[model samples]
Target: MKKNLLIIPSIIFTFVLLTFFYLLVIERNPSELPSNLLNKDIPIFEAENLIKNKKFISTNEFGNEIILVNFFATWCKPCRDEHSYIKQFNNNGIRVIGINYKDDPKKTIQWLEKLGNPYSDIPIDKHGRIAIDWGVYGIPETFLVNSKGIIKFRHVGPMSKKVFKKINLLIKEIK
Candidate 1:
């Protein structure tokens, strides 16, 4: 009985150590966005406008303008951090569309009100299916789609001054 008890504890210890090692070393990082879809056509998505609620907007609605599709949630702090940059994009003639991922409408509206809504059209993705179709693993991802509706670049976190500069250059190049 004593030997069995010791063996069980040893097995548990080994399992714990292996689990930690796998998590730290073998597991892939979550922040890395897949590059396979770059330069590909943007995914088709039609969602209810979060602001208006009654209207639906899709990829085809933006026409030939440079579209910035931002996947965010009201609870995401990084999304809030990038709101000003989105506003800047809007001011610079880029059409910014918001995809409110898996959030309550009331909270989303409240968050937008507090952050100052910069999205030309805010779409509600209450089930997050649209985000999944776009290969989004996390919140606050921004995709830059060209006038032809091809995805040119994807910004995977809160945009910084440097990132915005880079994005602007890409936008110009795509145009």
Candidate 2:
């Protein structure tokens, strides 16, 4: 009986240690930045437009237009919630492009239909390679790029009117 009691405590201790190690060491902190690419040239990516599915979208498509690149996923609630703000940005003459992160074309289409499409162009990043290139750690991140293709601002979560106003000011400054 004493041996069993000791074994139970040992097992509990081992489990606690393993849990601590997994949480603190093995798992990565989600907020960690792998690189400092902000305020630099927007990374170029080539992806198929989710709407058309025939043509490809690349950095070159932006041309001289200031671009707002939004990284979103169909499953993300915040991405759905931010759709109206994105529409407002688009209506304000800000060019908006969407990078659909690791989502199915059919589901993406359905999500857009439900939320109302706000993007001037929506590209499918089925593998998330483009998101990795842009240093996106989470969905619903946005980057404001200038006409020259330099990233001027990055917002890492659901956008609001206050953030939109700041982006608008940056756009005016860049223009």
For each candidate in turn, the TM-score is 0.78, 0.76
lDDT of 2 at 61: 72
Global local distance difference test of model 1: 0.83
RMSD of each: 8.4, 9.5
Error of 1 at 18 (Å): 30
How well is each residue in 1-175 modelled by candidate 2, as lDDT tens digits? Answer: 9999999989999999999888888755466454467768877777888877566547567658898989989889898788888988888878899989999889888888887888878888889899989988888899888777878788888887888788888888888
Cα lDDT tens digits for candidate 1, 55-104: 66465565587889899887898988888998999889788888888999
Best by TM-score: 1
* Colliding residue pairs in candidate 2: none
C-alpha lDDT values of all predictions: 0.83, 0.83
